[model samples]
Target: MATDDIKDTVEYSEDVKVDEKQNISQHEGIPRPEDLKQDMALQTGEADHELRERERKLLWKIDLRLLPTLSVMYLLASLDRGNIGNARLGGLEADLHLEGNDFYNALSIFYAGYVLCQIPSNLMVKTMRPSRWIGITMTLWGVCSTCMAATKNASGLFAARFFLGCFETGIGPSAPLILSFWYRREEMSSRLAVFLGSSTVAGAFGGALAYAVLGHLQGAQGLSAWRWLFIIEGLPTICLGLLAFVILPDYPASAGKRWLSPEEKELAIQRGASAFNTDTSNFDLRQVKAALLDYKNWLTALVYTGLNAPLASFTSFLPTIVKTLGFTNLQAQLLTIPPYIAACFYLGIMCYLSDKLKQRALFIIIVSMTGTLGYMFLLIGNNVALQYLGACFAAMGLYPLIPLTLSWISNNQLGHSKRAVALAMANTMSQTLSVLGTQIYKTQDAPAYRPGHAICLAFTCLTWGTALVLRYFLKKENASKDKQYGVPGEIDEKHFVGAEDMYDKHPGFRYIL
Candidate 1:
């Protein structure tokens, strides 16, 4: 829409081409090879890699400042999402005098709203500032969570849950858009890990926070401890919303402040500018269809969905899941902390390695297999520590996949518009599965939960099967294109790094996995 004039460099034009007829992010589109041939001639190896390294450091440092704040923000949001679980432990169901799984019905209803938000919310995010949008959502969800403190019955709880979903809509998908502002596709895996890893951090820390608040604040004034949990947990997010407005960087080219020296800032611009040679955009319907129609989108969706049942079962109900091991709710909540702690450790380390190696699928393979084994042990074995240790394994397994999977998707997508829409769609489809997952493990099916356990086991196998298909599919796709698109010694082809760097610079960017 903004392509009034092209910003011409030595060989390529800055206005990425897109046909308005089709729908997709205005960020990616078809580029002519003749244009790229000229552009590639200008790309200096010494200069490009040097500049890339510099920007990488800048973005890395940005995360050092950014991750803690965002991690804390997301931690607060996630705690609110699951606080209902905490409330159950403190007797929310009985207080409302709900009948026949009405509490779970409330959980399912929230996701109904969450399901509608993915694409539209991100589209709005592209139009607005992410810091502003996310902060607003944060404040709204905080209000919703706080209101939960006053809920009198199941109807009140249901209304709170729906509004909670509505208020919290934009934060998740929009987060990737912010991350893309700084990091290149290749760097996304680890950065994504840092972002999503907060879930693990939150899961563990929330339990501790709940344990402390619910334990000590049980009878404050006329409120129940669960109400206090909502109040205390929801309030910090308000402060965090204000903080994000002040601190989060919007985009590399348009970033406010002189945080980096001019030369360093130039490097950030040049890297993004150079990246346009391969992967810049003008959003349109054809490319949008291209993105949505691609096979990887559905394959990736299936992998994520397959993992969802197990992941939510563990993440949403871990304290209750642990209670089956004969621990009190307090002990169960305390024990839940350790697995998520272990998960955080594994997440940080694995993500670091993913960055260092620039390999995503390899790590996906390992984490999936490890998680499968953990779930298997839970399904059949009975030793308490061993079953509990399976939980640590379970925690470690799920945390890393999300970051890498998201990185894989985000990095491969070419432009801002395409990235935003696809990121939202991909994310929506993934969370859409939560609707099924939450309902699958009915309370009647608890304890051994043979059916639920069997279902999770099958899902792990789905992840593995999906991985195998992806590995083969990517290789085949790359090989066929290489036959047509290959040039002798144009770029390194001997080794592949998870499809990000290869396409981040080229619009011919086809999804490999």
Candidate 2:
């Protein structure tokens, strides 16, 4: 198991499955990359231990340094999207003289802008510094939200909301690419959960904050308090954007000048040793087209599209949905907090287990199926307690799946250009489905949209079917490769033997099921 020998292994097929057993228990004592290198030589590497330990550190850093900034940023971004729900609770409908899903149509129109902006926004973040690009977008979206505070009519709201979507597009997706810069595959899910749970928290937090603000701003500046909610919620993100440029580290290779030690920099560089997106080589249209040509990217997007349909409903309208179920505005906000809290813990545990087990698809399948059942509870259950618990079930089921699914794709797509585009493409595709999900809560089925419930159930079933299919495909491909040469993924065997060429040539690095 010498370094040279470890580097020499060749893989010939795209489905190069390693043994499913994670060997986590065995990788306990090894510390330091040097030890990891030695363990690699011994063929008894404490890789899992190292990866988990690294993930733990990253999650801590991300939660403290990165997520808070992004959370505030996304809270504003999410607030921009769903303030209509809050406005409906306020006097926006009467003031705007709107009737019958015009607001929903306005909400729907925002995505038309979103779909147009995301790809370009993401591409910019990659070429420019993420800190610079994301920070700038944060400031811009804050301005857009503030403008929403000034809307006089439905047409005004529509204009403000469309611009809001344009500004908000890259904030969520950029956060993941930034995380992917630092964290490994298994570590991504829980971190993603922690970052994303902020939106849910904002629903609760905004509920309370909105109550306080709306009540306080009722007379200020001749605008409604709901308008003030837009002003108040939107401003912090503007300042946060300035702070991000000053504080948030660029990428690891570029950031150590201030915080990370030289030793840490080296480790950071190697941490990406298993980077699915390794080659940042030359780029142009041909490369972009070649990256897009990979079937796996679209397949991943399909899985995410169906899954995001329900999750988007949860985020964009959960507060409104809860208010319909016989709760006061204050009560709805408080109630929303508990389910999101439940999601944080459930997602953390699931991510911990996914990492421990080193598996992705099964967890996704199970969580998704669980979410489908939760939606069923919404459809059939009449008891308030039970229906509320379904909200918690939705959290348990939906939130964890996000991190896992993104990690699955991030770990699958190779090449930085490819991974970046893949993230945007998948998210963009999923969001398109979300536009449909939003419209499904039709005016005709206002209080309880049984059709929406039924559609969610349909999406979850598709998730189950996709997971099963992916599992078999991965296994079958791996076996095929192993028989032809040896290993997973489709890398050439000759270069694989070179000290620096194992991954370069190993033809069997198959996408996960």
Candidate 3:
């Protein structure tokens, strides 16, 4: 097919979306800006075979260079954030003399710092660049995590956890923005799954690591096993953070200096064609306000919060929950492994299928429904085997929701600043829910924790309602735009650049459902 034809046929993906306004014929006659002229030629020319081959190579290089490093960074970030749960099982409560609700406050306080830092960290990522910003945050949080080993009382542990949350805030919001910088929208779901799947991997790894440290290092070096757990886990994360500073690349246009060759860099820039370009060059309060005012942003946040509450509960108390099935501490840690493994596999499969089929809402609904059933089983089932089955179902369902919701919103939002602010806002609201989630699995609800299970089931149902409403709104907006214009109106890159602060309001942009 010709360049125009190919552009017309291009799917709604992260890398390329078919714009209804522009035509190949018009593009050939238009004079582009000097900096963009080469990129425009490379795109509009009839070098189909060469473009395809180069694109294939470009994607492979990106997948190899980027995914593994980001995945590992996320893995350590998740591990540090979650290790407190494992340590709780390793006697952190007893060691610190945590009184009634002190432990709960410790968990909840982290989210206070977490909620406060998300927006600021997200805004800073663009200015400081991913390498410096993410690297700095990771290293600092690793230090905080290590200090958890030295805490002498509940207050000290609380302080350590709060700082851990502050430094770790950059990660949860940054991952999706960074992914958008590299992959096409269609390809992002699976890549995001890989990145976010770190949480599940951390669960399995955390359990196994806890089992080993608590089993063998109970008093090694005259420090308790919980202390050893913090030190051992925290040190490697610091090392990884230092490595990320040297290795992680910036956005594509600016990345050749970071890693890629000049030729590869050009390809990378072209991959994120100007049509859906997000301006990360400057900060604007208006963009922040726009994201705050946008209903879609808050709606997605609500759905995400409901889904995420269960995940937070699982991460903090899975071992405790499993132990209620009559297993010892060590046995509970070992038992937590299988469900996380199952969740990991299930997440991979669902992300792959979600991308392949080009759908998000259906998959989210199905996953939420499955999680609801899992909680139902946990609440009502009597047999130990059935309850264990419920645990697997519950865990497998919750972990994938965040990534899917993130990719969904990232797909919908148009501007860089808008997306950045929207994502941070979403993260803020979800973490707020997470704070409430920590309080749900109270010390009073020991063993069966029937109340916690019931709350989770309620939230799962809430997820379904919010997701469907968002889907309906997106469809309505698309339909309305289709009615208003017979075809898409013009979108000059010059005009877009000038008004990037008003992204998604333009007639040319369309929301993907």
Candidate 4:
């Protein structure tokens, strides 16, 4: 079939709907009127094969153009955000005269700004061009990160960190939301793995980068290595930010005009619409209210909280934790790389499996259990080898969950406004709790930080248990919906007629279990 034929067929079928007066129950095999129209549009044999080939190419083109750009951006964001831990080992605490709890306070303050800005920033991504918004925030955070090199005292450091968090918030929660616009729900986890995997790479890269900067760049131009660390990592982010304006595609509707042919653009939009059940463009208060009222959002947020508390502490203190294992500061930096590399490989595998099996909660439970066991080793192991092994397990377990949880939450939420708000709310609550993670591994707790390990262990277990509970509830809800409304059929625009305000509540919309 010609591209025009495909386009015309889709448009014609979309316009033609079963009569509203016909009782849906009267149709034995059909679940709803919408399915009749959708089935009419279904193609087979050579035409279907050709369409699938086009879609494959389109996805490949999009992934090449979009994923790497966003992944590198997030990698830079992670580097700047977590480099403070590296800087601490490079003598930041001593240079700044950080007292008891001062370092922790500096770490905690970043989340304060991070938590405050996430919801608003995510909402704004809908109104503004995503490229423009992301570019602007990336530039601002780069500035904040670089300015850390100039800080002479704790006050300056605190101020810089807070603003860093504020601007950095734009990227993390916004990425999955942006990806949702372009990819179908089942495709998200693997792509998000690539995006979120950058953070793991950042951990590995940050360690190597810090080692080089601290060893050679120290005392260069009267600046300490820690100062150089800030400047070196921060400058490239600004360049990437400016480049994002030209490189990052906004939404499929707008992006297709630039990169996709007319036929491809229509297919892309249709794909997104089918995945989301509604193409409600304008922001709706009802969607926002639905997101806020969603018990699943709160439950996922709690799960995120459990994951992030350990995540935050782990990223921020891995160097310190390793140092307590009888390694020098430089050796500790080098040692941190392996765990992150391990995590990167593990993350890719789990995400691929998740996307393949179309599963989220089971994998989340598995990884959370892995992390719990890792922390157990840290808590009870008598030797250095075991403790280091625990660190590797911890990295492998915690890093994968970030992308998994985000995509899981995004997959379940319907409509743009509701998904955006749900993502922001989850991030905000999780980041707020991450402050507790920052403070948990105190300086006094060095060399077998049992309490810290125990706390993280508890949180990981909490994550495991919560995933089970969430999966059960989601399964129960899906069963209940099926019993009440019959099994939902393939949803189309007509299915959303009276349910425009319903978002995910539309009878045809079922939660992904």
Best by TM-score: 4
Please report, as a residue range, the 10-residue window in candidate 2 with the lowest summed lDDT: 496-505
lDDT of each: 0.72, 0.71, 0.84, 0.90
The C-alpha stretches of model 2 lying farther than 4 A from their native spots are 1-67, 281-287, 488-510
Question: lDDT score of model 4?
Answer: 0.90
Candidate 1 lDDT, 1-513, residue by residue in tens: 112222333243467555567633244454444445556556666677886687668777677766777777777778888878877888778888889979778887777777787777777776677778887888888888888999998999999888887767767667876677666666677777777888887898888987898788888898889889889888887777877777776666556555767676666665554333223333345445666776776777777766665776666678888888898888877888899888888888888887788777777778878788877877787788878887888777777888877776676666666667667677677777777667766789778666776677777778767877876777677667667766324233232233334333242454425
Candidate 3 residues 134-163, lDDT tens each? 889989999999999999998898899999
**Candidate maximizing lDDT:** 4
Q: Model 2's lDDT to the true fold?
A: 0.71
List model 4 lDDT by residue over 92-171, tens digit each. 99999999889999999999999999998998898888999999999999999999999999999999999999999879
Q: How far in Å is the alpha carbon of 193 misplaced in model 4? A: 0.3
Choose 2 or 4, whichever is better by TM-score: 4
Ranking by TM-score: 4, 3, 1, 2
Q: How many angstroms is residue 323 displaced in model 3 relative to the true structure, after the best TM-score fit?
A: 0.3
Which residue runs does candidate 1 get wrong by more than 4 Å?
Answer: 1-53, 275-286, 487-513
How close to the true structure is residue 63 of candidate 2, measured as C-alpha lDDT? 55
